[model samples]
Target: MNVFPRLPDNLTGGLRRPNQVRRDQLEGAVREALSRQVAVTRPLTADPAGQAIRRANRIRRRRAGVGIALGVVTTVLIGAGMTHLSGGSDQQGPPIVVIGDPDLSAQPLATASVAPPPPPPPPSSKASADALFASALIDADGKRLALPGVGPAELAHRLPNGTGLLVVGAPTAAGRSLWVAQDDGLVQVLLAGAGQIVLAPDATQVAWRDGEDLLVAGVVGTQLIGTVRIAVPDSAQPVRFVGSSLLVRPDPTRPGHVLWRPGADKLTEVPEQDTLNVYGSLPDGRLVSQVSANSADGTCLALVDPLRATKAARTACGTRLSPDGVGGMSDDGRWLLVNGKVGSTDRSLLVDLERLGTTLDAVPVGPAVSGAVAWTSDSDVAYVDSSGWLVRLNVKRVRAGEPAEQTPVAGIEPGDRPVLVSGS
Candidate 1:
């Protein structure tokens, strides 16, 4: 029956009697909310709230260690400003070197590499006529005059300043003497005879022929000066120094026409009619005579201006020769060397008085051409060839028409008579 019926309000109230007033009203509302949170808390003190919470956790770990030491000093100032703006600071400094002057820089590159020294060798007229017969005091038998007691020295004259040697020597007892031979050893003699020995185009004077006397000597430095003696006409003939005067022929018995100029006393004749002699004087004082309009007409070679008694040029008519023909004038009178005969064959020309008659510049010289014919202080013509050989003919290469050269003078020996000493 109790399982079946429900209790009323008073019944239920009684059952709750054991609630102690609802557990004392829930323990007094949990001690009144823990006394209202212990009346707003406030009671801790280890020393002042435990050093104020250990100084607020050591100032939050010293402000997080000053923000991690200012983010590790701004990553070490951005890696030292990116290693100084990337040039890496010129790897950091110091090193360099240079020097030169080894004694002003040496030299000898072959004397600045070479090139300038080759032009001076053309004057050998057979070595100046073998050095004028090797300084001639004349002794290879007076240079072939065949000396012994001295009679045939025959080279009547020569001294185009190669010093001297005027031998007409015949001293077997001093008969036809005039033997000068001086290269400074002085010999002199003088008592002359068979004519022609005139040297003195400034070779300091020396004219000869002492038979009819016509002396005129003056040479200083080897001594022999002033000797004047002039008594001509015993048929006088050989004597020529023309130009400061003395070109005689007073009257070699007459055919030599007449040409005397010996002033200071008298003899001045100059007719020269068919004049057949006078070979050479020109260095402008002119007088290269050998004229003739008769004996069947031939020889004329003139140029006579014996002080303007005029005839300044001749030589055209027949170009003849042989009044004993043998010409020679070239101590710069330009050149003449004749020696004619042509028909019985003796011929030896070379003319060219600067082209004399417009075209016969001549230059034949063949018929074996022997003995006397010499010039070469570059006028070149030297001869001697009957196979004895000395030879040489150039004549400015035959006046430039070319074919003349010839040249064969090695030791000279066609009996050795080469006389050309005119190097002026």
Candidate 2:
């Protein structure tokens, strides 16, 4: 009765407290989780000034730690191409971390470029040979010599093999007569109606044009054997040999040329061409011709496809040549002798092909007597002078302002025009 009413016994039983041991275990687990979530070394003091000072010190230490980490990141970045940064919630800026070894420096891709092939090697050691000056076969010493089986001829050219000479006579009703002046002095007259005779540069083959028939044969020790006749489409004149292929002009008035193999029927025409007739070929297969039109004076020489068939490829022009002067390339194709005029005088100029495609200037040896010009040696150029003497001019001597060595080649006055031999 006092001031409140009495509680029921059953209510007291239902209001029992939680188990003490379980409650203690649960409280400990909650305390451990709170401790992990927030770490604290010491509790804050009740003084406001002390708490403010402690907070300032903690901030300064954190800034110093981040600075040290940034220094480490900068050192590593010096040796790495790139780096990454990982910042935590508590940090203002984080250090960059590097992974595996990476390229220290990056560069751009390279550009493509190609270089042209080099020129052919020089010839082997010089050989003892004879010079043909105005139809007269003369030795290197400029003495008139005679081939045993052959007599005076109209035109002649040296065989590339230096084995003999190719002699041709005036064209009669039966056509021009041809013969090979052997090294052993045996002359072999050509068989099978050979005309327009053109010998291969290798000296292993010979070819001629007979009507529409193109006759090619193997040269076996001064003999033209194993003849193969192929029918061509036109009256092609044999021009010159570019390796095993024969270069022919389809028409004398045409501006181009075609190449044909002896054993095949296919014809290959040069890609870019002009009216210049290819009279000589380099061992590398470039064509050398005469370009007279639109030049300064005399005759201008040109080099076609110095590299290949592209308009960007250049054409080199030589200096003025004699109006009707003689010119020929050396056997090694290293030097070019053009009958050129300096002033009122005709001089045999040496165009050093080693400096070809660069200059048009030439080295004048002297006045040539006969129109014939030939290479006497790798370094010597031979020509007949006004005294009918064979002048051998060493290029080095001529370059040094020295005189040419003259030898008595012939004593004839005139009427010996048709019997000349040369490598022209």
Candidate 3:
């Protein structure tokens, strides 16, 4: 009986039926080939001469089979735009066939074999772009079905687009620890280190300060793949991420004020302006700031891209920039909430930083609204009130001539566990 039925010519890749027996057969074939390599590298020389000869013959036959199987697998992989095996290995063990390199001069060959035809050219960027919408689908049990070897509990955060980045921390022999995660849940380790990590919007890499020099690490499959250090001043604050781009703020006393470093390739600077206090860079390349110089009657909010002011305007009405305090920007760059001052009293203002730099409304959260002001990607802001209540303030309705209402979003007291609010 035929142990294996031939797969149909019409059965395209990635279209195989679930739990298909052929898939297991293919995996076993590859495993057998790998086992042969291991056996050759660890030869059993203590066996009887007859047994040793038999083992050697078996190794030779298996090696030949592996060479042939490898060629077919390589062809299939190349056609699918997957990774190609590296050309060489540094170990002194018996050789294995690799796809790209033609000159097999390192090891003696028992026999020659035909190389499969090369794969076709890659698809156009437009087509490739459409096909690259990677996503992870999680079941009700909080388990991600598509990502291998990861549970929902392990995920630190999921991007708006659904790609998840997981971090696993383990202690070293000496007592220190390291954490690593796969970048975009692919084979790349996004970060593996002892320092703090900040993932960019693209989720491919991160910017971290190892010590004095700021280093950017590429992620590959729950590991820190590689790192490149960027030149930064000693006085420069620790690294921050603005969509995978590094935002380096040079010392205020230094010649240049704000330096934006995108990966290892470029370092851009915003000319030192007397009025601008470089707060930080937004993912869309805008700066979330309050005006310090020039036309400084009220707080100044500006949109800067590539270190240039794309749009500059002052906020209106109750939204006056507080001299002693500041706040946050919405995820979409649509709003900037400033803890402004109304006369001698300090208040919070929800500034509509999108259409116009106008104060949408102002809410009196009292003076105790000091710590970190939380903006939940929407127009709402949350802060811990003095009465020990986590209050959410929302600019519910703002009409042309109507006063903006300051209503309690949801009050969380000591008893009820405050639900974590995030995302748009």
Candidate 4:
């Protein structure tokens, strides 16, 4: 029978009978010792008291050394474990915590850590594609081109030149859309949802109202720039830009337009008109609009400066305002064209503004309110007749003895009325 010293799983070996073999060997050694009469006696102590004291001291010293060694080992193990947990090794771990996260379980970010790990950076304030929410043509070179319909209502206001901007209307279920064009036939949309589009007198900026908020987006010469929400307290807001100033009209009743410089903070008020709704201003310092009273035709076709009310900015060449006429100012701020059937007369009047006080011939475009009209940047007026023909009227020709009453000066076939969209 093999009797073996059983070992725990921590010690790995095969079974054997070392215990029995050791007992037999010990018995043999004892018998041999007895036979030889080997005395194993204790030697007499010369000083028993001193020996006992020395033995006790040795035992105490051993115990103290063991305690000290145990403490040192424990401290070493704890330090190693902490180093491993703190990313002290070359191994990778989980993501680090950030300031905005709700979870507090993650470890705090280290300020002087040598590791490359750090929190992600915050969002930047630079211009992004998402900032441009919507755009509609505030003014086009020619035509009203209202998004909901396809007639003169669609044409912006025709000018003596072929360039103009279409007034983009409010957004509906169908969507807010406006098309503006110049002689180059380039069309741009200023707003896409619901709102009213208006251009500044300088033709460099466009402003609109979305709900109760006012938004300005426009181009300075060729560079696009604007503010999203310019805070104002009232509704029926009206805005315009003249030179370097921005004017805002924010009252519902007895309202007046406020003017301010773009990069400055001061504001001033524009003079009030008796009945005309102010549409916009011109660079040459003229305000354009339609008459307030439906029955009064004189003021209906009048263009007067708010700064100087006595002097009419524009008036019919020889006759007063036509009863059933529609008009708009040229881009150069020197002419006004009224299109409508006047007092049973079928001729439209193209009035040269400079000749309002002189005897200038009124160009008679056969007595008919055709499509919408707008002036181009180059000073040509474009209109569409009932036949849907695009007519381009030359201001120089009308002034240089070409006769103001020429209806279809030069036009395209009566087919597709291209939607016109202009930059504010």
Q: Pick the candidate with the highest TM-score.
A: 2
Q: Which pairs clash in the backbone of model 1?
A: none
Q: Model 1, 327-383: lDDT tens per residue?
A: 566677878777666566666666766556612345565544543455555376555
Best by lDDT: 2
Local accuracy by lDDT, each model: 0.51, 0.58, 0.44, 0.46
Estimated TM-score for each candidate: 0.26, 0.57, 0.44, 0.44
lDDT digits (tens) for residues 1-424 of candidate 4? 7599666443456544344457788999989989777566656659788899999999999999999999999999988875554422222222121121111113321222223332212223522111111121122333222221111224242222324333343446644444343222223343444355556544556565556555565443212354544555656555445555555655646434565554444445555444234434456666654443334344444454555436455543334444433555666666667654456566556665555543334566433445345566456666544554445557777556564333322223345443333222
Please give the distance, in angstroms, between residue 326's alpha carbon in candidate 4 and its true position after superposition.
4.9
Better of 1 and 4 by lDDT: 1
Estimate, for each residue in 137-164, the C-alpha lDDT of model 3 and write its tens digit.
Answer: 2221212222222222222333334333
Q: Which lDDT value does model 2 have at 337?
A: 72
| Per-residue lDDT of model 2, residues 48-122, tens digit only | 998799999999999999999999998888544232212121111222211111111122212222232222122
RMSD of 2: 25.4
Cα displacement (angstroms), candidate 4, residue 212, comes to 0.9
Off by over 4 Å in 3: 1-205, 218-221, 238-240, 252-256, 272-284, 294-299, 309-326, 355-377, 381-388, 397-424
After superposition, the stretches of candidate 4 with alpha carbons farther than 4 Å from their true spots are 1-171, 174-190, 200-203, 220-224, 228-241, 245-268, 275-284, 288-303, 306-326, 345-347, 358-362, 366-379, 396-417, 420-424
Report residue 418 deviation for candidate 1 (angstroms). Answer: 4.7
Q: Any runs in candidate 2 off by more than 4 Å, and if so which?
A: 1-135, 147-151, 157-165, 183-185, 232-235, 292-299, 306-308, 322-326, 368-373, 385-389, 406-408, 411-413, 418-424
Residue 175 in candidate 4 has what lDDT?
41
TM-score, cand. 3 vs. native: 0.44
Per-residue lDDT, model 4, residue 128, is 17
